[model samples]
Target: MNFKELHNQKTPLLLGNVWDVPSAKTAEKLGFQAIGTSSSAIAALLGYQDGEQMGFSELIYFVKQIVTNTNLPLSVDLESGYSRDPIIIAEHIKELVALGVVGINIEDSIVKDERILLNGEKFASTLIDVINVLSKENIDVFINVRTDTFLLKHSDVIEETKKRIKLYENAGANGIFTPCIENESDIREIVNCTSLPINVMCMPNLPDFNTLSSLGVQRISMGNFLFDTMYSQLERITKDIIDQRSFQSIF
Candidate 1:
């Protein structure tokens, strides 16, 4: 089945979020149904902050490497498409498509000194322009429109998220991704509000896979948690090796 079709399954499609070739390869070896890049994780790997600090070309190179080294269907976290211009975003999408990517998560928020949500209506319009450009070229991509309402903890978040869901769906989005949505009630309400597959990121309080499927979450993402967890373990192992004056951690 195709990448998009994976979301239509009765249970949620768990995306193994990877940062590099090793991570992607690991996901594949573990029998993950699919994999996607973690923009924050990738940026951190390159000694940069998240939110498009890494250049689009750099992202392309890294994605190309992962695609070349793996057989699984891959999606990318475009992180606002690396440009405000919708046409440029479409061009970026085209480049990823050429590299064998099947889906993308493009968010509606941008980072200044801190994160902030873009005007939902305006962002939806941008999605329209971006999708239009891709359509003209006959390119098909799973445009998983990522909205930051829950992540930013906006007041009236659920209502605002449902509103953005409609706007994004109307703008030709194939799915809706709202990071930091951990509540079962919110997930069910959001899923009830739209036909688009709802994607939730890994949060401290996020429900288990069975609960998520029961709530009608069509997709689940690890975001950057796996990358963080792996490195955190490595740091601990190094400390243990230093204290013992032996490379015991290697075993």
Candidate 2:
């Protein structure tokens, strides 16, 4: 199935990301129409760090596994497309498409300064080339261009967010992802920028389902939150065991 077509919905497709085959099946059984793979969660599962830990070959294997286990259209988190070279990144995009991924989340948040950094003009330049290359491949790969400005820099967050969206749209991004925005006004500004779908991180204490739906957010991702929650829960239980305290089911 062409995954981008799924996003052309009256209500945005709410994708639940899975790290492994079982998780993908579980999500599929839970009535989620589409399933995504989390790069963080998958990397943690394989005992590696995120971003280029596993090369395209290994990533292709994982995507194939996810596809084999379930029939849902898969959207993969190809962390920074696994390379800096736009040609290599484009090749990786084609590899993912060959592996049956219907969508991909490519981000400009290159790891630097111990946080996400946005090289606005450079990333935009690369994105245009990447999209152009993929178009030649003749696959309608859904590109959810991720912008990490809000998560990294807070100064004039609204203006920076708009700038990134404009650049991404010009680069042919199917949608725009602003990972963590604090307030509703900022979300509104992004919503007003372009008609393309806007994506947000699903923070527990932040916007509720109704609020997100009202804000015109077409996509909401859990990112590493689910993986972090798993780690925290396991650590808490292990600590309780060491302390001889009753580990009641907190799940």
lDDT of each: 0.94, 0.81
Stretches off by above 4 angstroms in model 2 are 238-251
Best by TM-score: 1
Q: For model 1, how does the per-residue alpha-carbon lDDT over 9-85 read when each residue is reduced to its tens digit? A: 98999999998999999999999999999999999989999888899998988999999999999999999989989
Scored against the true structure, residue 225 in model 2 reaches a CA lDDT of 82
Q: What are the TM-scores, per candidate, against the unseen true structure?
A: 0.99, 0.90
* Global lDDT of model 2: 0.81
Model 1, TM vs. native:
0.99
